[model samples]
Structure formats: structure tokens, C-alpha cells
Target: SFRFFQLDPDWISCLIDGAFSVGRVTAADAAADQKLHQKHVAGKQPPVVSGFLLRSYAVKGWPKLQVDGYKQTAQDEADMDGYKLKILRLAHLSPNVLLCLFEGDAVAVDIHQKPEMLHLGFEIPDTKTPDNYSKNLRKADGTDKDNYKNPWAIESIQPDPATRVVKVSQLFLDIEKKAALNFTAPFTSAQFALSMVEGVQKVRFVRSGS
Candidate 1:
């Protein structure tokens, strides 16, 4: 779990509109969080910042999270897992997802919970090819392990962009955090699928658990 963040200080992956990054956490926590992108804030009023995901009106990147009332909450912190997020870019959508990035005033950490690995007993057509969140556990047969071939379904995808090589790493993190557990939320999984691939123009999610 080597969760990397704004290592350059000037770099921030935007959390969603109501989310903030959790800092000063442990490497183990960071590692676990990186491994699962799950985190909870432990303060009555924690400092909220932007995540690296941003859609600044000036460049190629993920959309930013909008914080309406930055300093009005008694318990200002949030369980990033507690809120729903969405990426408003229609152009970035595809039939097969590539990956997602966060780039604003955000700090993510790990939430402690024992999640069972869900087993969706079916195979996707192109499990070997990487979508936004696929882990390349390719075997000698050029196929992936069962888990890699089939991961937990994601609840929702927050659209962000990045040309960074590390983008895939971040995408994998997202899968562990969101998809592995609660895969059901208010989102069109079909639209998401269409958002990932090109030309085929349709998606109907098959049931699979992480």
C-alpha cells in the first residue's frame, strides 16, 4: 500500500465537493488507504482541502470538487466514503474506463473495516485488457487471475484526467476503495460502461463482487 499524494506540495488531487484530504496519517495507513482509497477524518472540525482531481478551466485534468461552505461545520471532517461524487465531463466518457484522478483540496485516508471479497462468478469479454481500474495480474497464458479478471463493481466513478504514468496506480486504488465493497449506488453502470469503451456504445453491467 504505497499511496502517493501531493509529493510535490504544489500537487493536489481534488477530492469531491464535500471531501477533504486526510494528512499526517501513517505510511501503513497511507499504504492501506492507497491499497483501498478508503479513509475517515477524526475531528470535530478538521481542515478541509481539495483533492488532486480537478477540471480547471485551463487544462487537461480531472474536475474539481466544489466545497460550498468550507468553514461552517462543527465536525468539519468527512468520511470520504460517506459522500457521492460525479465527474461532469461528457467527452471523457467511454465504453471501457481507463482510470480516474482527483486534483483539488483533498486528503484521503483509510477507513477501518473488514470487507469480504465478493465473488461474481462470471468473466468479462476482455478481462486481460486494462480498463481504468484493472490490475495486470497476467499469467503466462496472458490471462489474469480470477480477482484481477473480475474485481468488485464500483459504486460510482468520479471522472478526472491525468497523463501521469501513476494514473493507473491511482485507478487501481479507486477500485479497491469503492468497487470492492458497496458497488451499488445511484449511477448508470451502463453509461459508465459506455464511458469506458469506444464505438460499441452500450453497457450492461454483469454482476461481480470484489
Candidate 2:
């Protein structure tokens, strides 16, 4: 019926102070196209971009999403289940904008028949240690809630880095270009070897002409 989104606690004050408002990235469908699509709506609905999970690279914070407990339930029971999403950096001219980037499988939102009609739920993790739990247990229990011996403190999703993978292919390509410009190794050999080949060819041509 509802979905949970995790956000950093440090941004709480800034957000409450009206520093910036959250924006949703929706499908850019033309008014005419939207009307036409609505007319032909049937059993299966088309996929749409509900919104994006925003992360700011400017914040020196970790991003993480962890499940506390394991429950055996039918997949159909959930209206919308949790899934992994790829991090993408948006190119912006403004220096104030965050440049968060990630390389991995992108997540697509499910096409709901009447998504707006469904109830929406938003939750922010409460990291404060409850009366029953010790203050020292706050950080550790937040992550491993199910295993923790505490019964009062609700599990808080701590920040963690989402983009764990490095683009090795692109990294190698950049390194190759840099090495050639800096005259590092094999490129040095190839550059000089071509001169010798050209010299031998010129000598053979002169002999043949003679």
C-alpha cells in the first residue's frame, strides 16, 4: 500500500528550513500524446517514471539500505516491493548541484494502473536511542536491528555509498590516452618503430627506380 524512502539525517534541518524542495522526475509526455494514451488504456499500463532517489555528492556521508528482518510472504502480497536502483550523476552548469554518479543496473518503476489513487507513505529513520536501549547501542543496532537484543529502539537506515562499482573499461581507456601523451612504455616503442619502416620503404623505392 505504501513505500519507504531513506534520507540522510543531516539534511533534516536544511529541509525543514526550506533550503530546497524535492522534485520528481516524471515522464515528459506531450499533452496530446497523454490524451491519446489514456483513450487506449487497457489491461496493461505503460511504464512511467514515478520519481528518482536523490543523493548529494557534496555531503561527505555514506548511503545504505538494509533489510532488518526476513519474513516469508507471497510476492503478490506487496503492492510495490523494494528493489535496487542505479546511481546516475546529473550534469548541471551550477556548482551548487550535486554530481552523484553510479554504474550498475538501472531500476524501473512498476506501471501502476492508478498510482495517484493509491495511498502514499514517507518515513525518515529515527536514529535517537530510545529509553530502553543504551546510547552506545544506537549506531550498531540501527543497522542490525533484528539481531540486536534491544526491543525499544526502531531500526534506522544508516547512510552508505550506493555506487560500489568502478567503470574499469572507461578507466583503462583514459589511462591509455594519458600514458601515450606522457610517453609511458609501449607507445614509445610504436612511435619510433614507424620511422624505421618508412626509411626502409624509401630506400627500396629508390633502388627500384634506379
Candidate 3:
């Protein structure tokens, strides 16, 4: 099996100059995926949905010239100070998807001839565990300081296969000094209808109340 990776111009130059070599490394946590191992044993291949690039640079001390493992030396600890960029595979889309909802007998929603507001969607974390994002950081020194946190967002929403019950865990909304409002019943029970609106796909969740 072969995989393709998009590289930067500097990396391309290094490859041409015979100064580039590749090494294989897997995350310590992800390597323990029992499901992935079971599939491998059964001669089944997993689909690759995306690829990530971790680019790291020095912040203070020079990079240590040694092998990386579960163990770390003093220089390895000190050299961990650096910045990293997560390069994600992205594609261009025009007339992006949006969500809208309406209820009751008749509700008039108008789209004018003026420019529409552009929306940027962020991918929410699927799991509450910080193990997934450990490699994304420049310093994977195994410390709480390097752990990822999403204070004002939904950590995960798991739907039970045996029942209609859906569980939402670690959801936070920071209103900052404003009175907190709760919509626990309707928000969880609200059903969304997804359809094409003006040639753009949308997921509309009609509100039960204001």
C-alpha cells in the first residue's frame, strides 16, 4: 500500500538535494486501538479520511540530536519548547451549507439580493480524552500543561445504539456575568430536518421556544 503526502517547498528542496529521509512513527495512544488491530488481523484495510502534518520549530534551545522514545533526557526535556503547525487537508467549496428552521402554520423567511454572511465551521472534538491531540502540540512531553482543553464547547455527543437516548457530556457555555438559561428538555429532544435550500444543503433545527 502507498500513501501520498503534500510537502512544503523547503522539504521538496531537501528531497532533491538527497538531504531528506523518512521515518515511521505512531502515537503511543492511537497505537493501542484494539479495533484497528483486529481489522488488520482480519486482512481488512481502514479508510484514510484525512492526513495531518506536524511542523515544529525551535523556540529557545537547538533541537536534540537523538532518538525519540518513551524515555526523555534533560536536553530532550529542555528542547521541547517550540511552536508547531497542524496542516490539514482541505478542499474548496462555494455556496457553503447553512442551517435554518421554521415552525407553526406559516413563517416567512426571506433571502435578499444583498451579499450573504460567510460562515466558518470548526470541527468539534469527538472525544473528551486529550490523548488524540497530544501529537498536534510541539511538545509532547506528557504533561497536563500540554493537554488540550475546550472549555466553551461540546466535548462529545454519544448516541446509544440500543435506545433513542443521546448523551451529551462536558458541554459548557460561558455567558460571562449574564443570567444562565436552560433548555435541557427541548434542545436534546429537538429533531433537525436536513434538506437542500437554494441549492445549498442545510440542517434546520426548528426552535420550540424563543
TM-score list, all predictions: 0.15, 0.16, 0.14
1 or 2, which is superior by TM-score?
2
CA error at residue 74 for candidate 3, angstroms? 45
Across 76-114, the per-residue lDDT of candidate 1 in tens digits comes to 346333432232222322232222233322233221112
Report the number of backbone clashes for model 2. 6
lDDT, each prediction: 0.30, 0.28, 0.24
Q: Write the per-residue lDDT of candidate 2 for residues 109-191, one digit (tens) a residue.
A: 22112223322111322467222221111221113233245443222222223643434344334334532233334533343
Better of 2 and 3 by lDDT: 2
Worst 10 residues of 1 by lDDT: 201-210
User: Candidates ranked by lDDT, best first?
Assistant: 1, 2, 3
Regions more than 4 Å wrong, model 1: 1-47, 54-122, 125-210
State how far residue 167 of model 2 sits from its true place (Å): 43
Off by over 4 Å in 2: 1-47, 50-82, 88-95, 99-210
Task: Write candidate 3's Cα lDDT for 113-169 as tens digits.
Answer: 212322212233347742221111111121212124533222233345566243323
TM-score for candidate 2, please give it: 0.16
